[model samples]
Target: MSAAPSRPVCILGLGLIGGSLLRRLSDTGGPAFGYNRSAGTVEAAVADGYDASTDLSAVLERARNDDAIVVLATPFTALEPMITSVRDLAPDCLLTDVVSVKEQVSDLVRRLHPRARYVGGHPMTGTTESGWPATDPALFEGAMWMVATHDDTVADDWLDVAGIALAAGSYVVPAADDAHDRAAAAISHNPHLTAAVTATVGAGESDLALRLAAGSFRDGTRVAGTAPDLQRAMLEANSVALLNTLSETIDRLITARDALREHGDVAVIVDDGHRARRKYERIAGSPPEPITGVRIGDARWQEELRRQAHLARVWMG
Candidate 1:
């Protein structure tokens, strides 16, 4: 079947991710608008000739009328109220999100707005910046934007959600909510924690240590510069997965420490880490396999899409 027509989009937050999305969709001349709680943000977007407002109710009402896809781009802590608004104002809208945590947001939608056709999404892209001023229309370009799939996921809704990601120049990776959370914990969330710790240690050592810090330290601690509240919300929302991943990471560090103390060698940790880094480099440098021939709305569509995602495939549809 052919892909669904690009639907009008209503983004619920106009922060970095949401603002960037608004800019992107507007740049492409697609029907899109956004709501920001901050009037200043609304004014800025308006000044840029984008349709944005501080009125959540009006935005949702418009979405309901237009059958727009409502993207929740707010922080995890802010999701409850934003979702409640979607439930109240646009109960039948197609819902998706860019929040870092998938399972929690999916649960919130299921619990609060069961009537909404929901497909959880998390774009694996961002900088250590927040708000509209930091927004870049090209932020999601060449990024992996996970369009979540589940047993109950509607294929058409999934396609609608993936359409937005594709229009923003992102590759769509279909994944289940729990799988997305677990993988995100390993690659994204845990690394934030480690970056924080690394930055703290380097800063606490001495001014001289920080002064001498170069590319390695800067690259390692880059995400530690992300807003602390944002970091906490992301890490805590996926606390279980983050804890498990953190434990594994801590074990590796302890093992390395012990090996160094006992044998004056850290070869095991070094070699293993080196191999893992090389594997990452190889995969990152390679092009993703394109997924095709899978018909949406088929009985096993979600399963097959997820399988392709696990194999590092991209589905443009």
Candidate 2:
């Protein structure tokens, strides 16, 4: 009897994130298979020298259990269905995702495929633009990659998974699902929404206001131009964390407003804001220190999760 053929590693969703991953995999000398919701995306991917299709089952049929890695690069709203389809079609293959919200997706994976090997990931970098045309091969280069896996529940080797992320030129950060989600909400999603609000506020101003808009306005509102649907999914999925960050933002604004109203020193307000912003930039710009080699207790892990959860709830509320 002949043995069954192994399926090829298939990347689902050929948008910016998916296309970037496909480009990375192709550079590594492998024929990366791609699946997208749009036929145009699939055709473009095929023309780019990678295998491409919109058929889920057909893509899975070409994947092998060991060599096959399913990367769901879709939006947060499409995650559950995409994951469910992958699980049903590629039961033996390892599953991973590029979704921004890890906690919600992780929970869904755990519930849907209790025994299936899965890893939740979030790449902490992307441009305001999207689609295949917006995809760059170096998109993930020097970026932060968050890998979330439960100790007892996860079966597939995280090292193998981490290797894939490293190959894409990212520094891997091993964190709990919840922690990754909350941190991303604070750093990425919340910032995008705030930038959008800032941009909208300036829209009503005169041409004089536009001319007066210097580097501050440009820098502060850059992310506001990101795709509305993508931004919506990210902010809505992690609303808890986003809200928490928003609250803090509101409080700061209130403080500044009160201080200014009370005839506070303008220099004091500007200096305080500058220092805080600089500190944030420093922390976010730094690389993730390796936390894999060391292991901690269940209590510690639970505590950390609780802390992340609390932050999300507090901010979102």
Q: Identify the leading candidate in terms of lDDT.
A: 1
- Global fold similarity of model 2 (TM-score): 0.85
CA displacement after TM-score superposition, residue 70 of candidate 1 (Å) = 0.6
lDDT of each: 0.91, 0.72
Task: Record all residue pairs in model 2 with backbone atoms less than 3 Å apart, i.e. clashing.
Answer: 7-62, 7-63, 7-64, 8-62, 8-63, 243-315, 243-316, 244-315, 244-316
Tell me the lDDT of model 1 at 204: 99
lDDT at position 262, candidate 1 = 95
Best by TM-score: 1
For 1-317, candidate 2 gives per-residue lDDT tens digits of 01111323578888888898888767765556788889888787778777788887778766644468788788988877777777677777787888889878877887887766887777778888898888787898777677675554343345445556777777666667776777787778878878988988887777788789999899999998888898898889888888898898888788888878887646666898789899878766664334432333443543443344333221100
